[model samples]
Target: MGRGPPVIDFSPFYGQDKAARSKLEDEIRNACLDYGFFQLRNHGIPENIQKEILRQSEDFFNLPDGVKDKYNKDVGEFNRGYERLRSQNFEKLTKGDLKEGYFLAQDLPLDDPYVQARKWAQGPNKYPSEVKDPHLWKKTVDEYHFVVSKVAKNVLSVLFDTLGGGHEFLDDFCDHPIAVLRLLHYPPQEPDASELERGIGAHTDFGAVTILLQDSTGGLQVRDRRTGDWVDVEPISDAVVVNTGNLMMCWTNDRYVSNLHRVVNKTGTERYSVPFFFDGNPDFLVKCLPSCIEKGEVAKHAPLTVSEWMKGRYADTFGGSQEKTAKEMVEV
Candidate 1:
C-alpha cells in the first residue's frame, strides 16, 4: 500500500484500544492542519456499490439529449435535478462550468404537504425515467446515495474525536445534515482549446467537509497556499479524497484552511468524479471552541446554527437566489 504524508489506517481508530485511537487522533489533527485534504484508503465503503454507481452514471449520460433534458435542474431554483453542460457558473465567477452534473440530496418525507409548497428550498428530485433503462439508473443512484451517506458519517466520527469532542457532538447535530453528492462528467476536449476551459472552476466548498471519489484521469488540482501554484491531486484506486470546507474553517477559527481547487481537463480522456459534501444539520449551533480561541483574542464569529451559516455560504458559493436571510429560514 502506498502511503502519503499523514495517511493513517483509520480502522485502528475505531477499535476500543485507547492508545491506538490517541495516536490516530494526533495523525488526523496533523492532516487537518497541514493538507486540509487527504487521501483515504481501506475506508470500508463497499466496492460493488461504488462500481454500480459509475456504471449507471455512464448509462444515464449515454441517454439521448432530449431524455436527459427531462431532468434539467435549471427549470427551477431548487436545482434538485440534472444539470447539463454550462448550467452552473464555476469559472471566474462569471463564466459557466463546461461540464455536466447530476445533483442529488438526502431524501425527505414526501407526504409532508409543506414539502411541495416550499418549491425553492426543498422539492422532490426529478428522477430520469425517460432514459432507456430508467429502473437501473434510479436504483443505482439511490444505492450510491445510501452507501456514501454511511461513509460520510463514519468520517465525521473521526473529526469529532480529533476536535476534542465525542461522536455525539456531531451525531446530535447531523441527524440529517444538508448533505449532497454530486456526480460530474467531464468529457475530453480538443487539446489546445480545452486547456483554457475547465470541468469545474476554482472554488472552495461552502459546507463543513467534502469527500471526493475520482477516477484515475488525474485532472484535479489544489492551489499550493505557500507557492501560489496548482498541485495535481493524483487518484489512487479504492481511495477517497477528503477536504475541509468553509464551516470547518470557521469552527477551527481559520486554523484549518479551506484550500481552493479546480478540475482541469488535462487528459484527452473522459473523467467522472463523485464528491459528497456534509453540512451539519441547519439548526445545530456552531461556535468557536476554547481550543481554537484564545483568552485575549476576540472570537471571529458569533454563535450560529449550522444551517444558517451554510445557507449564507451556499448563497454565495452556489448562488442561492432566495431573498430570505438565515433568520427567516429558522422561523419557517
Candidate 2:
C-alpha cells in the first residue's frame, strides 16, 4: 500500500452499475480491515459548503478570547460549545492538546425525549454570537452537519453490506445517532516543543466512524498496524479522510481495525480541521456480527448500548469530574 491512507473514489457507490459499486465496496472494506482509514473523493458534499465552513471556523476562532469564552463548554458537558486550548489531553501521559475547538451536534429541542432525559451528548448546540453574521454562521454549520451526516450514513451502509449484512441493518441505529462535529484550530508549535506536546494526542476515536476535512497545513498521522510506525495523512484537496472507530471494531469482532492517530502541527501556519463523529444511536446495542465471528470462535465483547460505551470514553478523555448531568437550560 502507499505510504499514506488509500484514496478511494466514492462517486461510483451512487451509480447504477452493480459491478462498479461492488468493486468500490471491496476497496472500502479492505481499507477498513487493513488501514482503518482512507480518503474519499466525489463524496457528494458541495464544494461551497466545505469552503464556507472552513471560512466560518477561521472567523470564529479569530475572535477575541473573551468573546469566545462566553460560549465555553461547561465542566460537565461532554459535547457542545467552545473548548479552550489545552483543555483536553487525549494522551494520558502527554500535556493537554495544544488546540482549541468548538463542538456541536443535532440541534434537538428541549421538549425532545432524549433532551428531557438528559441523555449524554443529546442536546442543542451553543453558537457564538460575536461572529460577523451569527445567522450565517449557524446556517453554514448546520448545513455542513446535515450533508456530512448523510455521507457518514452511506459509508456505514457499505460497511454493513461488506459484512454480509443488508444496507438496512443499521437504519434504526442511525436514526438518532450521537453525532458530534468539532471545528479545531491548532497553532504552530514552538521549534523546540517537547515531544509530549501535541495538537491532539495519539488515540483511537471513541465512535463508529469519523469524517475529517483538513486544511492545507497538514500534520495528521495514522499508526501503521503492521509495522507500528506512524504515517502522515497529508491533505488532499476536496477530499475528506474517513476512519473506523472503537465501536466498529467491537461490532465486527475486531475484524475491522481502529487505528491510533494523532496530530502535531510543526507547520508554521495555523491548522484547522473539521471532524464529524457519527457514533450511531445512543440506545442501539453494539454486538458482534455473526459473519465476523469465525465458525468456532465466539463474540469477543459483551453487548452494550452506544451511550454506555460513549460515556466511559468521554470520562476517560475528559476526566471523570467532567462527567455530569446534561444542562437544564435547553434550546429549541
Candidate 3:
C-alpha cells in the first residue's frame, strides 16, 4: 500500500462486539499515533439527523447577509453567532477563509449570573428571519446537537479508558457541558487560484474534541505526524471525522495530540462541514493526567481553571497565534 495518510476501515466499530471493538480501539490509537487523523465510517450517529442538520445549515447560509447578521454573537467572551465572511481569524495569515459560519451553543439559564456576566462569550442563538418555517432551524439543529453530544459522550468514554483511566473518568467533567456546532459554507474558488492560500488555513481545534460531518465536496487535509506532510482527508458518506483538541491534550497530560488540519477548495464545487466542539465547564480545573507523566520529566504546569486557560487561548486564537501554552500539572 502507498505510504500516504493511513486510511483504515472504521465501519467495524459501530456497535460491534468486544473482540471487534478492541480492534477498532487499536485502530484509533494507531491513527492518533501515525496520522493524527482518520476517516471514520458507521460511527453510530443516525443518517437522518446528519442530513437534517446539513439541510438546515444550507437553508440558513443561503439567506442574505443582513438577515444572517441578526444572530451575530454579542456574548461577552464568545464569538458564537453569525461570523461574517472573512470575519474569522483562521484566514488572517492569508486573505480570509472562503466560508461563512453560523455558530450555535448551549443556551445558559436566564438566572445564571455567569450567563449574564459573559455576555460576550455566551448568549442565546439568533435565527434568520428568512427561514420560512420558524421551527425548521432550531428543531433540526437542536436535535442534531442532542444526537452528536450523545456520540461524543460514548466516544470520550472509550478514549479515557484507552488512556488508562476508568470508563467513568470523563463522565463527570462533561455532565452539563458547553459545546458549539459550527455550520460552515465554503464557496467554490475561481479557476487557476491557489486554493490552499485562499481556502481555510491550517489550524488545530480549540475545544476538548471535535466531530466533523462533511459533504461530498472534500477540501479537508490532515497532517501526517510521522511524515510532517499534509494529506487529504476525504469524506465517507455516513462517516464522521473525530480529532483531539487542545483541552484534551492538557487533560491527558499530553499523551495524545491535537491534529492540525485545513480545508482547500479542490472539488470544483462548494463545500460545507459541521463540527461539534465539546468541552468541560469553562470553570473546571484542567490538570495533567497521571498516566502520561513518568519518573524523569517533572510536571511543570500549575493549576488553572479551564475558563481562565481558555480565555487566554481564545484571545490568542482571535489574534491568530498557532502556539498554545501547555501547562504541566502538579502530581496529585
Report the C-alpha lDDT of model 3 over 66-133, residue by residue, as the tens digit: 78888776443456678777655564565666778888876656566657776333556565667867
lDDT string for model 1 (56-80, tens) is 7777777777878888877865557
Model 3, residue 53: C-alpha shift (Å): 1.1
lDDT of 3 at 15: 57
Q: Which candidate, 1 or 2, has the higher TM-score?
A: 2
Worst 10 contiguous positions by lDDT, candidate 2: 323-332
Most TM-score-accurate candidate = 2
Best by lDDT: 2
lDDT of 1: 0.71
Model 2: pairs clashing at backbone N, Cα or C within 3 Å: none
Model 1, residue 299: displacement in angstroms? 1.7
Instruction: Assess candidate 2 and give its TM-score to the true structure.
Output: 0.94
TM-score of 3: 0.86
Worst 10 residues of 3 by lDDT: 323-332
- Across 143-202, the per-residue lDDT of candidate 2 in tens digits comes to 999999999999998888888866565788888789999999999999988888899998
User: Model 3: how far is 326 from its true place, Å?
Assistant: 7.1
lDDT of each: 0.71, 0.87, 0.70
Per-model TM against the reference: 0.87, 0.94, 0.86
